[model samples]
Target chain A: MTADPRDLVVRGLTKRYANGALANDRIDLHVHAGEVFGLLGPNGAGKTTLVKQIIGLLKPSAGSITLGREDFVANPDTARALCAYLPQGALPLSSFRLQEVVELVGRIRGGDAPAVRRRVDHLIAALELDEWRDTAGIELSGGTRRLAGFLMAAVWPAALVILDEPTNDVDPLRRRLLWRLIRQLAEDGSSVLLVTHNVLEAEQSVDRLAVIDKGRIVAMGTPSSLKAGDRQSLRLQLSLVPGVDPPAPPPFAHRPIRLGQRWHLGIDQSDAPEAIRWAQDRMAAGVAEEYVLGATTIEDLYIRLIGREDALDRAS
Target chain B: MNLFTRWLRSYGLMVTWELRSLRTVLPLAFVVQTMISSGLILGLGFLMHDITATQAQFLAVGVTVVSMITLGMVMAPQLIASQKQSGAYEYLLSLPVPRTTLIAAGLTVHSLIALPGAAVALLIAWLRYDIALSVSPIVIPAALLTLTTAASIGFALAHAIPNPMVTSLVTNVLIFVILFYAPINFPADRLPVWLASVHQVLPFGHSANLMRAGLTEGLASSVGVSFAVLGGWALASWSVTAWVVGRRA
Candidate 1:
């Protein structure tokens, strides 16, 4: 019987730098093919190190990385030929024009010059680098350079593409373009391993995510699945009738506001049913107004999984 | 494909780019230095009262050796140091290509830059000295040996220490010290015993001696031994350079 397509396996992946510090400690990861996997982490969570091992850049101290049963460590050249990596600090060669850089990398994929040229032109137009095709890398703006760097890797014919912070300096429009390109890649049956701290970006881009914290995976699942938490809350506001004082919200509610004789309640997602029943009872008691249910956003999950206070501290 | 062919392909590509870079930097220097050295050697020899064919040929060989040293010790190091600072080497390493190709390509370019100077020196020597120096069987091999040895030594030094200012200082000092013991325009008869003893071990003096022997007369056993010595130094330097670059990669 043939092996299944969902077959990336990493076991006991350990990496200790020469300075006696543990970067990755015996981590295990299994990523299915044709699926988008996001590596979410804080700045120094060893995300890049783990990605390096996966890309065959750095050797793990103790680990067995396999792609569909073939040993990646023992046959790195073959593994590398099958995958494309866009490193976090990737930059284009200053001497090469945008067209030249793209064409060169495309040629490395064993494509003929005409085919490579066609692909380069298509990518340039798709990425809106048409006007900058002849411009050197150093002369381009920071965001444009980043786009070029990303396109070079994405143009490869490899099965798996690993991108580190693809949208770091990209603006919203370019980010949309990049996402369209990524979705196209996934639709073409390629696996994309996205490493980024932009939870909002990852929220929309990845089919699934693995959140890493302090050199280990703290959580892993689809975006919706991971964000599905009991702590989800809805903020409901009720406008009181003329000349009537607003009533207090339930004990679970906090930050109740009285705006123009109105009442607001913060109720959890689970409490929504009971809270709605209570609201009906209050409405029968003549406390009247409309309310809004705020579904928990990915940003809220970001804070919950990491920590809100810690994020604020980091931002400060 | 075999490893050698793969490496050779990469080396050819890198060498082409390196030569393109040299066009802006040392190509002019090579032409000007060769002309100046050739003119000086011919003019000085012509001014001598009893300059014989052998002595003029000797002077030509001496000037050629000096030119090779200038290109190897000074120009090669400067070019490599600039490439490192410009992030060119890092760019090359980031490619799937081998590092040995990069070093070998650089050395090949260095040897190429030295060729014009040697050719000019030999032409002036043959013309002004009125010596019947042809492309002897020995001259081709001797020149190749000297070129290869200079390139390997220069490359090894550049790879070992890639700092532009430091490499310049060290190369100049090394060239000066090596010149003191080598037989250039000045006669080697007045040298001290200690210095003469040191000259026996140094490669420049031996290189000049071998080249002079090859052009003016047929190759003797002693010149053959000098050729062997130069070849040995070249082999060792190339080996060490490959090792260091491999380890760093």
Candidate 2:
């Protein structure tokens, strides 16, 4: 009945279709106040479904969603009154002029005509949507319209704001501005749920994150927390000559992943003492031309965790 | 604001948004509706050798009934289905407005569209057949009830079957029933007793009967039954639509 105003708690959340395919299984997550919580997953990982349930667009087969003090599923009015959602893909309000979409959301959510106007103007200027202000959503470029959708949700600040794949297809400059804007929204005390597949950007942007795969959270923690176990492992990234095989499996608690043409071998800290020597031997053997040794990062953790799950899935 | 006021605001806002978008295509929509609604009446006039004034008046009103039914039962469902395909349906549903309010606003716009088409048909009847329509206040309420009933059914169908292709097919089938099979253009007694009994319960025959009575004095045999049947359809369809719209995908 009483919960923190700037938080979302999802517990024992499960979604199983009538055909008996489990999309999400007992997923539990706690998004804290004033922090951007990233729900990172590949396609078909139930990230969208979970967000849909949280936004009251989809009903879960089990469990409850609590955003702030209200049960979002049981009391959508309160939940929506206190929260805003930006769905994935381009803006769906393509029929409306850019400014009209902004104003509609502003007025509907905020209910203060003048204040919403001011905020709409401010966000338009900040996100540089002034030029396309009169254009319909379909007329603007992809990034411009996407920014409009984001502004629609952010035009009136709320306790909890949910954005699904907010940065997909956006240019680097606008993505940066958008990230800054998201950070500002959280700093102003909005709990931001950023669901995305861009793991690299999420690793930097999220205060805390969860890695989901095949309908379950494989990993959940801050970027630093996810990397806590990785501290024992050193990342050995190397570009090997074509037609040449990868280096012999290193004697360490390690997992090697191929990213494009390069190979990255994650070696445990105990073996960290030998990873450089090991890389040196491979380099001298002419098996590698370029090599870099660094601390294991969030991407490493994500790959390692999901890699295990995928392997088990194949076996099953 | 109170709950009623909140719902009213949401309904008005939704209609405003939909109408604003519709402004660009209003001319085309008008042409299509006008052609379809009046074409049926005009074709009857041209094809028949010696159609009487009373018969012409009945045909004009029946054709208007056909237009309103097609707009609500055929057009509304297809439009909602298209919205679902374009992802705008989900976006609209996610808004804080009440679900019924959204449907009401949509029904209002579609029903409003039906009127102009009916007007064009009435104009054709006056200019061509010299039939004078009675100024009956009941016509307004009758059209509102009839359109709302049909629109609710269409909305229910849209949510029940969200696929655009399937919905289009279904709406086409419905249009055919309203145009040829239903008693909208003729008295239920003209059909076999079994079919007439079925039409007695259905809202379409009642719809045309109500419209005919409004346009011509003392023509409807049972206005009360017609109003009751149409009201029942409205309530039943509205219930189904509200239930289906909240269902999980």
Candidate 3:
């Protein structure tokens, strides 16, 4: 079967910087139309570099990026026309009012004036930015400015929307609204590529996700599929009393990781009864504050997939 | 939309954006420029015990050239460097508008900001020194070329350098040289022969010569050579700017 014209297909994408740093190794991925695809990675994992290549800000060393029938690598103008990018940095709207910024971007992208204005109004209301509509960009808080930046891109939806760290610095309430807007865009038939390192959010939000490490894609699939390998494993998290050393790991448990006042350990389903008994005895002896045993989360899987020791060290 | 229509629309929007975004700074910029231009005309007169009509004309015309060059060479680069430091440059490049439109809009806005100062200086010279200028039609192209060339060179410098601090330092040094070291307001022959020879090949001396030709008839020698030289510099500088802006990696 032929692919839809709006699908994004990248094959053998590679980028080697002048300093001999391979920012992106040979990579392949496909994002279908109307899908919310996520690229999850830690800092410096080449997520931004890959997005830059797709949007024509950076040239690939060797790659084929096709959107529908068009070659994005060779035709950058088409890439610009077809994709809308919300960069990781703050938007350059210091002098423009929130409403004006969105309308101007839409018009510049060739949206009809009346239509652009309508969409701008809708986005402002939807994003709960009505009170700040006339406020200049510099006067707004960082999170508000970021929301306005999203409006600037969403007011004129392109074939593909690439948002890098869209939820950074956003409050929980507005973040939910932002995610809803992203879903609405996908429902309206645009592909959304979300780049972030927030593992829990990715697990809940994306239709599919790729975990990148050291310029390579370590894994890619639906959330469930990616976590399938850990289905039989249980996670035991203990909140230890202050000034108490972490307890030793049980025989069936994986290495225990101490994160400040808490310790996290993974164990098999058969070891759950013994793990809980051990936690109870420790709490009774005043060595632990509380304990909870649950299924392994994407965060745990992510740590394990990328080498837990190194990932934990970086996290700390 | 057709290509022309799309370009025209994008260009209009970009110009509006630039003007509105800079509305606050522009007023101060205009005031500073007017002060600089008028200050040079009046302040330099103190150096002459008995100024002649020819000397007054040179000073008057030279100050106007200074005003034009300052906006393009000094102000443009500084503004661009600030934008780079603030991450606006990358955001702008990611937009779908034609890259040329951005350059054109910038030049237009900066040129407009420059004009009132040049005019004010000329008026001051007329009122203070009572100097009469020929004011030939060549002044139009001469002024346009001077501004475009200077602004292009500034844009090239700002984009070519990766560090905003370095670009800012370079522009500051450039303004110092243009104001004190270069033969802009003064006749080139007043400098050492070697320096005068160097000015022949540089754009600064040629820029003043073209403006002088426009402001006073017969004041500028080799008008054709000056135009050719200024035009060449404008072309080369603009080419460099376009290349830097268009490069993707």
Best-fitting candidate, measured by lDDT?
3
DockQ values, each candidate: 0.09, 0.43, 0.73
Q: Please provide, for model 3 over B137-231, each residue's C-alpha lDDT reduced to its tens digit, 9 standing for 90 to 100.
A: 99999999888888888888888888989988998898777777777887888889998998888889899999998988777989899999888
lDDT of 2 by residue, A240-311 (tens): 878887766676736787755477798776676687887788789998888888887676777677664232
- Model 2 alpha-carbon drift over 4 Å, by segment: A1-5, A89-91, A232-234, A237-253, A258-262, A267-295, A308-316, B246-249
User: Compared with the true structure, what per-residue lDDT tens digits does model 1 show for residues B1-249?
Assistant: 698876676676667656654555566877776776776676776677688765666676777777766686667876666667664554344444566767777777887688877777767766766765545577777777777788788778777874766877777787676545466654455578787677666667777776666666642237867887788889888887887665421
Cα deviation in Å at residue B134, candidate 2?
A: 2.3
lDDT tens digits, residue span B34-98, model 2 = 88866787787777769987677777778878877787788778877877777777777777778
**lDDT per residue (tens digit) for residues A47-80 in model 3:** 9999999999899999899999989999888898
Clashes of each: 0, 1, 0
Best by TM-score: 3
The TM-score between candidate 2 and the true structure equals 0.90
Question: What are the runs in model 1 whose C-alpha is more than 4 Å off?
Answer: A1-7, A90-92, A234-316, B1-94, B97-249
Best by DockQ: 3
